[model samples]
Target chain A: MKSKTLVIAVREYLAAVKTKGFLVGLILMPLLMGGGVLVQSFTKGLEDPTPRTIAVLDRTPGETLWAALDTAAVKQNSGTQVLSVPKPRYTLKHIETPTDAAGLDKTRLDLSDRVRRGEVTAVVEIGPNALKPRPTTTPGTEPSEDTAEDSVYFSTNRPALLEVRDFVSRTIQTPVLAARLGQSRETIEAVSKSSRDVLASRGLARKTDTGVSFEPRSNEAATLLLPVAMVVVMLMVVLVGASPLTTNIIEEKQLRIAEVLVGSVTPFTLMLGKLLGGVATSLTLGAIYLGGAAVAARQLEVLDMLSVGLVIWFIVFTIVASMMYGALFVVAGAAATNVKEAQALMTPMMLVVVMPMFLIGPLMNEPHGTIGLAGTFFPLTAPLVTMMRLTTPPPISWWQPVAALLSSGLMTVALVWLAGRVFRAGFLLVGRPAKFRELIGWILKG
Target chain B: MDDAIAIEGVRKVFGDFVAVENLSLRVPAGKLCGFIGPNGSGKTTTLRLIMRIYAPDAGTVRVLGDSRHGPADDRVGYLPEERMLYKSMRVGEVLTYLSRLKGYKPNRIEIDQWLERLALPGVARRRVQTLSKGQTQKIQLIAVLIAKPKLVLLDEPFSGLDPVNSNVMRDAILELKNNGTTVLFSTHDMASAEELCDRIVMIYKGNKVMDGTINEIRAGHNTDTLRVRLANLASNFDNLPGVACAIAEGDHHELQLTPTADAQAILRELQQRGPVELFEIARPSLHDLFVRTVHEGAA
Candidate 1:
């Protein structure tokens, strides 16, 4: 760097780092994130613990289904609590089946009123043929919807109570199967126990010189959380570093300080200086957050899950992304005469910066899929998408990341060059900001 | 002496607006020249062209003997018409930063010295936003001269200053000229231009209307006016022979003469009308010349 540019960079860096807002933001981001997790954990134990009473109208002739449901509820209620918080208990209330359709409608209305008044948590109508075995369907074909004869109608106003639904569905399976087979429940239990060892999932075995060795259980942190976390951190750092450039530049122009600085150095030099300064500021912030995370991970004995190679890649991507976005932000600042105008100009640029976040889910689902590969090659999304793909299962080829870095680096250079031209043309314009077309003209003409 | 700045046939345009056209000028080294013009008369544009802030569409601008088409080197300093400084920065820091940009690494003591010289002592520690308007203007001047450039361009350096501050600034400018630095400033203060400029260049509508020493410019205009003090306040020179118009000055009347009119004949006519205590032919002032040139261009 030229000495003049270096001087400017030093000033710009200090101007940002010395502010109270920077300090507050640096500390607040992690606090808020950590606070959210803490709130979730604390709120988990606070869920309602009152036992739920489910009204059952068993229309089967044997009347054995209610007895089975009562026994199942007792078993579930006796299960151990988690985190010292009791699980929701269930109590079954048997209701006699109506003799006619009119009688059934009156019974249904009474049950609905009871459910609304919280006297009963839900109503379960077990159809007369519920225990009859379903006809077999062909392989790869979906079964038809259950008819009223074999359907178990579980109705509740609180449809979001998924745990209650899961428990009821799981407890009735053995009894329903036993009735159709004309066997005792013990026999069905015995068959289920025998089939329990029929299936298991394991990682692919590696062939060693001694023998084939099975891999250890997958680490969720290393495989799933690490890459997503890294990409999020990269996004945060890049934004924290580059987004402020627009505000700073607009402030300088509005204050009329840009012309004085422009008088001393070339516009490109001034812009490059500010960009480097912003990068330095962002790196400082990232280092603090990452350092804290590292210490915490070490305390949790999960430090090994943090890959050094991934960290290096994080820095490389952060620099490339910051420069690219920083130049665009600088262009926005130069093309506008005030903060409002700059914000208007920056909306599309900001959208492009954040576009990768929306694609993270698809990229994570298929790390080597089309969307992932496309994001890796597209410079704007490469930093985020490529980072996420690196940590997902079924690792991508090595050449993808290398190519992504190269392409993004080249794009950064081109953007900086374009930003320099717009900056030179727009720095002295104190009137209304130039339109997008005018900025394009400046870039091309320069 | 060598020319400090030389512009040959400069033409600058903004969209369809021609800001400067077919203009040429030269200022010798160590001379203080005043660029005088009305608002929107292209004076600031001309100064910007010299500083290379705006490159001419078709012209050559050589500064400090270098003809390269780029920003002026560190040997030249410019204080723009709009006084601007980093409001959040300490005055001393701003000065040091600007000085460094000119390739001069000024220390705190040197910066303090410049502040002291500008009559802005004890302000080096204050943020620019905290300073008053006049103080900020003085600090801006200090920023321009801190590097001691061979040539300095000041656009409306005294625009917002009070009489005392203006005097301080005028003294500082004179000091620069005395120290062999070329100074070119643009202003509408004709009296100051007449008082301080070693040479004057007047522009109207993107063209040079007049350029010369004060005496030379005055000599170029015909001495076709007479100033007289008569005993009677109501004495009118309107009906006098060879007089075009009469304007009242305090305790006197100035009679404008036609091309065929003689100053002696006008004085004689005034004497016949009343007891004339004083009578003399006077050259037009710079203010008059500026107004006349603008009107002529408009016509």
Candidate 2:
């Protein structure tokens, strides 16, 4: 029986690892996630030496705010090339006319041809009260009850257009503040230049205790994300990774292999073998995914924050969650009549496993607070919650996870026993799930 | 006794509906025993009970001297009526896995040898879903036989097989019996049952209706089948003195003899009209016995 179980486990592990779906997930998850981070770094890697083509639609007369706007973007260490033309090469361009009515008529005629035909980026109308918010309340009276914006209009579905609008608004708003100083253009320009330098110089001075903050973790810093990621992996291992394993068992039962195996071995053996096999299969897939993440992260710089020890946690939690869900899934898989029922069974179980993630705020607010401490202690929810706490800077005591590990070990045993009971009788069940007495009688004996 | 299988006074009731009631029977080692009955006559239910899939409500079962409910090391094999093999698994892998579960590591050479022996060598590496029903049944049979258990119980092993495959199965089963393995098969095909079974036990509606060797059963029932051909087309044997009834085929008439009379007298009279083409005496077959038994049970 022991040999058979081990054989079942090994066979299951190898078979799952060799499957196309598992292999794809194993190769693709790390590549996709790590690739996302890599893609970010690659996109971020492009140097900003070249000036940007800054297309502006300033409707204010004689470029009233252009000089001030150019200096503000320079303070942020980026360059801009100003473009103001009779007709810009984008949609939503303004066609200046002699009068407001004339302008409206011309815009009506040209808006379709220009904006719809992509002649300008946007129309910035500098009409009467164009850049001003008209006062809604008098100084001596109670405030009016309108809780809405003054006005701005643009075509729907162009979110990037807001960047252009807000830039112009900021460029114009700064001069309104500058008007009170009653300074000449040259004086305002000098002061703004001095202020921009002061801000840029201070930005470089903002790094405090950088070397010292990471120095304490220098020896074990390689693996800080390991503990946290392991917990996440633990949940994912059971929730997402066990899909095919459960499907394998369910398909067999549907195919009637349960009875065939029962004829060869004891029902108890079959139950245990299948559960262990599922666990082995799930863990094996997890290892491949973890390994891929490690390799892909090594090639790119960002993923190096996670350590080999994190991979170890992945193995441990994976084993724990695997057995836990493996036992659980065997019963569910046995009860389920088809793939849809099995999926329906798993969705709730998955939500239960991931519910702690939704409450991460409570747990992270105080890593050792009553709620966080209890979350760390509770076996079912601890793997994710405690590890979530560990990801931050509290330097959680080692005793916490040791205690959790013990409780989970004991919980796994209990769950396996209960699941074994369910698995043993559930395999023989046909039609719908039975009532209590009938279910119990199968376990007891006819 | 070291019987290959013995089910005694076994009763199984699902809720208020009894599936098997006080069923008792035995099969000696090294025999091909046919288990025959109608659809709801408890054949599959009895097989399930024998496999301990559903434990009997009362009484006990012993297979080859070991209790049926004992651990799996007991030398026994089962092929269920409903087929099940891993669809995605390579044939060799699945067979090896199942064989390992049955307490043996199947060698590829031996597995291939068996597959070739069963004329399924082409499917050894292919997935099970790609195989035809006959091919899959062949694989299933090989899987059950790979361990070479002392006893093998098959439920409708020939249900969906075409005639050729059915013949192959019959031959394999006879070979197993010759190899000293006790075989019990439940089937609805009475012709196969008649040709294959060494002994039989018939049940209906959760009760054993008849139990015996084929000859004993034929002798007990009023279903004697005669091999009598008419001497002339003008002759009518229905009104003959000793003939109870007669059924005519293309060139022959089957006559049933009256209990108190001799069939030789009728044969002599039929010989007078013209020379008889053929005449022979044979007992009624299991099909005839089955029909008579069912009619008697209803009566």
Candidate 3:
């Protein structure tokens, strides 16, 4: 950089970094994110843990089903105590059922009242032939309500009690299956245990000189979280770093300081200086956040999850995205005569910066899919989408990252050059802000 | 002496509006030149062209003997008509930053000295926004001159300044001239232009209507106008011989002479009419010249 540009950059960087707003933002972002998690955990610990009482009405003409359900609930409740936060316990209360249809309707009405009054958590009604095998229906055909004898109805006022519903549904399946097969409980248990198979996913094993070594079991959740986390962090850095350039430039122009500065240095130099300054500020923010994350990950023994190669890639993308967005923001500032106009011009650019976030899920699902490849090649989205692809399973080929870097780097240069032209033409422009068409004209003509 | 600034056949237009047309001018080194014109008459545009802030559509602008097209070299400084500075920065920091851009490493001492010279002592540490309007103007002037350029261009340097601050600014510009620095400034204040400028350049409607030293410009115009004050308050010179026109000016009357009228005869006629307390033939003031030039050009 030229001495003049460097001087301007130093001033720009200090001007932004020294502000109280910057400090507040720097501290507030992490606090908000961490505080959200802390608040959620604190609220969870305060949940009502009283065992939910479920009323059961069995019309299958047998008392064995209720007894079996009671035993299963006891076993489940015992097993939950070993965990850090015990699961919700369920207590079954058997209700007598009548043979007549009118009596059955009355019993259901009483149960509905009890559920609504919060006297019981839910009501489970077993159909008269719940243990019987379900009739097979042809494809695309449905069984009529009157004929669906194997159905069980579970009703509750609270739709969000999914865990309670799932527990009851799982616990009653064995008892019903044994009754329908007319087999003893032990025999059914043995058969069920014999036929079950558990599937576990693991990373590919590599062959060593002496023997083949197996890789550790894959944590699917962590695998998905890493790339998403990287992309989120990158997006935050770019937004924080580049968004301020527009306001700063607009302020300088509105204050009429731009003309004085341009009198000393060319408009291009002034713009480039500010761009570098913004990039530097963003990198500092990223380092602070990522460094804290690294320390925490190390303490949790998950540091290996963030490989050195991935960290380097994060830095590369952050710089590229910052430059591209920063230059465009500078142009927006130069073309606008006020903050409102600057914001109006910056909306589209902001959308482009954040558009990759919406595509992250698809890009992670298929790293080499059409959308993923398009995002990787399109300069604007490449930094974010490519970071997501890097962390997802079925890692992309080595050349993909290299190609993305090249394409994005080239685009950044082109944008900076274009921004310089617009800045030169618009820096001294005073009065109403330029229209989009006029801005394009400046870019083309300058 | 070499010309500090030289523009040859410069033409600049914005859209369909021609801001400057076929203009050429030169200012000798170490001379103080006043650029005078009506608003929107292209004085600012010409100055920007010399500073390379605006490139001419068709022209060559050479400043400090260098003609390369880019930002003006470090030897030239400019203070725009609009007074502005970074309101958030201290006065000293802004000065240092601007000075560095010109390749001058200004120290705190140098900034303080410039501030002191502009009658702005102890303001180096204060943010520009905190200063009064006059103080801000003085700081802006110091920002331009802190680098000690060979040539300085000021646009409306006295626009918003109080009389005291204007004197301070005027003294600074005179000091620059005495130190062999070329100064070119534009303003509507004709008295200041006449008192301070060694030569004046007047442009009207994008054309140079007059350009010369003060004496030369006055010598070029007709100097047959006479000022007369009489003891009789009802006296008038409308019918006096060889007087083409006459107008009352407070207690005095100004008479315009026909080309062939004699100054001695006009004086004698004024004395014979009444007790002439004062009588003299005088040249037109700079204010009169400016008004006449603009009016005639408009016509």
Candidate 1's C-alpha runs over 4 A off are A28-35, A48-142, A148-218, A305-308, A389-400, B249-253, B275-280
DockQ of each: 0.50, 0.64, 0.59
Residue lDDT tens for model 3, A306-334: 78988899899999999998988988888
Query: Which structure is stronger by TM-score: 1 or 3?
Result: 1
lDDT of 1 by residue, A126-214 (tens): 88998887888899999988887787788899888777777777877788889888889999999999989787756568799999986
lDDT of 2 by residue, A265-288 (tens): 666677676667667766766776
- Model 1: CAPRI class: medium
Docking class of 2: medium
- Order of models, best DockQ first: 2, 3, 1
Off by more than 4 A, model 2: A38-156, A160-162, A180-232, A239-241, A292-312, A360-371, A425-446, B68-70, B120-132, B162-164, B223-225, B241-244, B256-281
The prediction achieving the highest DockQ against the true structure is 2
* Model 1 C-alpha lDDT per residue in residues B1-299, reported as the tens digit of each score: 89999989999998889999889999999999999988998998898788777888998989999988664488889898885788889998988888888888888888888888878889889999999999998988888898989999999988989999999999999999999999999998999999999999988889888999999999999998788889888766667888888889888888888889877766667777889898888899999999988888889
* Interface RMSD (Å), every candidate: 1.4, 1.8, 1.1
Lowest-sum lDDT 10-residue window in model 1 chain A? A215-224
Residue B254, model 1: Cα distance from true site in angstroms: 3.9
Listed per model, the TM-scores of chain A against the true chain A are: 0.82, 0.67, 0.79
